[model samples]
Target: MAIGDAQVDAADLETVAQQLGRTPRGTRAIASRCPSGHPNVVQTNPRLPDGTPFPTMFYLTCPKLNSLVSTLEGSGLMKEQTERLAEDPELAAAYQRAHESYLAERDAIESLGTQVTAGGMPSRVKCLHVHVAHALAKGPGVNPFGDEALALLREQALWPAGDCSAS
Candidate 1:
């Protein structure tokens, strides 16, 4: 069955490879696209082609977006999010739902046994990149923290508005 509109082709793989500086592992399809029609959020397999165990299901491959998320990470935004996870009960429940949602998507592709959700979901927020990727891949309302981070990115004008997957 086709996964939405993102059927990964050779060119898409090459573009992601160029952006990552290496061949991405377990990438199955483009879950979300950049505004410029480039692969941004990718759906990855729980296990890679070479038998590597990858827990990250939705992988963000766009270099521009990745760089922007890295900038947010450097600014201690993740810590703030993590603190909010404890300070707000509703937000924490929503984050847990996001964690379950992420796990369900990954299990649909391939079961990974462990429930090691990415970005410190249902608890802490270690990586804004992972949360943001989750939000982008799954769309809005699935991951509240990810959505909040994306909103901040948009507000700060840090979201990549151009293609970052050009080879």
Candidate 2:
């Protein structure tokens, strides 16, 4: 394993070793035979029911996992906020007030809809390239463009540490 790789618990490690007819040390020796096979270096480490380690390991790009975790965490936070707002009478009243105001504004707009238009016909215009730049960014989990440009950016960012000079 690398100097600071994530690891499964000792109990899980022992269980995996036992299932394979080997000691925990032996299993770790085999699994960590190389940095590539090490749990810390790898993306995933499986454990037995009792939280023992398993032989097989799976690897994935860390940035992808980071993006997924961030998105899921945000979703969970939003869910909690929504639930709390639903259960709070003060918040509910505020929401109801806003809802009524929105409805009144909508009705006013509808009443005037026919008066505001292009030659008596309502028309909608939108800005071009509104999201173009945003869509261009290579965010976490996004490996677009085959990582070449991103690798260059990464190198430029690292500079002396690892060639992180921006492309």
Best by TM-score: 1
Clashes found in each candidate (C-alpha, N, C closer than 3 A): 0, 13
TM-score of each: 0.90, 0.23
Tens digit of per-residue lDDT, candidate 2, span 60-157: 21222223324433545334434545477664454344334323432342332222211101111111011111112212222111122224334544
- Please give the RMSD of candidate 1 to the true structure: 2.8
| Candidate 1 clashes between residue pairs 3 or more apart in a chain or in different chains | none
- Candidate 1 lDDT (Cα, 0 to 1): 0.81
Regions of candidate 1 where Cα sits further than 4 Å from its true position: 1-6, 165-167
Error of 1 at 54 (Å): 0.6
Off by over 4 Å in 2: 1-73, 111-167
lDDT on C-alpha atoms for all candidate structures: 0.81, 0.28
Q: Model 1 Cα displacement at 42 (Å)?
A: 1.3
Worst 10 residues of 1 by lDDT: 1-10
> In candidate 2, how many clashes are counted?
13
Candidate 1 lDDT, tens digit per residue, 13-62?
77778878898676778778898888887788788777788888888888
